[model samples]
Target: MPQPATGPTEANTFPALCAHTHLFPGARCRLQGLSDPHAFTAAPWSIGVDLRFSDDAAAAAELRTGGPDGPVLAVPPYTTGAGTRIGERAWFVREFTWVDGEVELRIGGHA
Candidate 1:
């Protein structure tokens, strides 16, 4: 994981982690109601997410099935130059283990 920011605004934590891990945080990354999005200031890829369908179980199922259609939850591999957007595409639940309400995402991207 990247070092915790000295101060909130002093660091771009998401970009730093993506740079190190080459992966993004997905919808389950949320620890609260909603979080500000992230982008790579410089890197090889970017990620995007659409939470409009988060409340829709059908959408979630489609995402889990890797369907090409449905809510675009965890889109990935955006060019590094792509500008920052409202959400960050992230790892699937399979990448990490969730026990009870706790998550063990060892590769970072927790925003």
Candidate 2:
């Protein structure tokens, strides 16, 4: 497993991670409910992540707290499988939904 990035200052680029895997720039992970993976870019100041969990229990646990728009959920620090570290400050759950045993979560973050 790759170690988490210490700070944004340590690197010039920060990529997105899903299930501890790196989604290389312009690459998207195929999930049930999401047509495109949530993406982050500094050039235009955009950030978002879309995750699909097949494990019902895990998905339920993630949504046990506030409602979809109630509270902001912080994304835990994680390094991609390729050894890249995502050092963003905060990422909150923007949307949550379940379908056919799959839980889809839409998360967003600030620049």
Q: Locate the minimum summed-lDDT window of 10 residues in model 1.
A: 37-46
- Badly placed stretches (over 4 Å) of model 1 are 1-21, 24-74, 81-95, 99-101, 105-111
> lDDT per model, in order?
0.26, 0.31
* lDDT over C-alpha atoms for residue 29 of model 2: 25
The candidate maximizing lDDT is: 2
Angstrom error of the Cα, residue 84, model 1: value is 14
* Candidate 2 colliding pairs, count: 0
So what's the TM-score on candidate 2? Answer: 0.35
What lDDT tens digits, residue by residue, belong to model 1 across residues 1-111?
232233233422221112221333442332111122221111111122222223221111112223333122243333233232333453343333333332222223432
Q: What is the RMSD of candidate 1? A: 15.7
Per-model TM-score, in order, reads 0.20, 0.35
lDDT of candidate 2 at residue 26, scale 0 to 100? 28
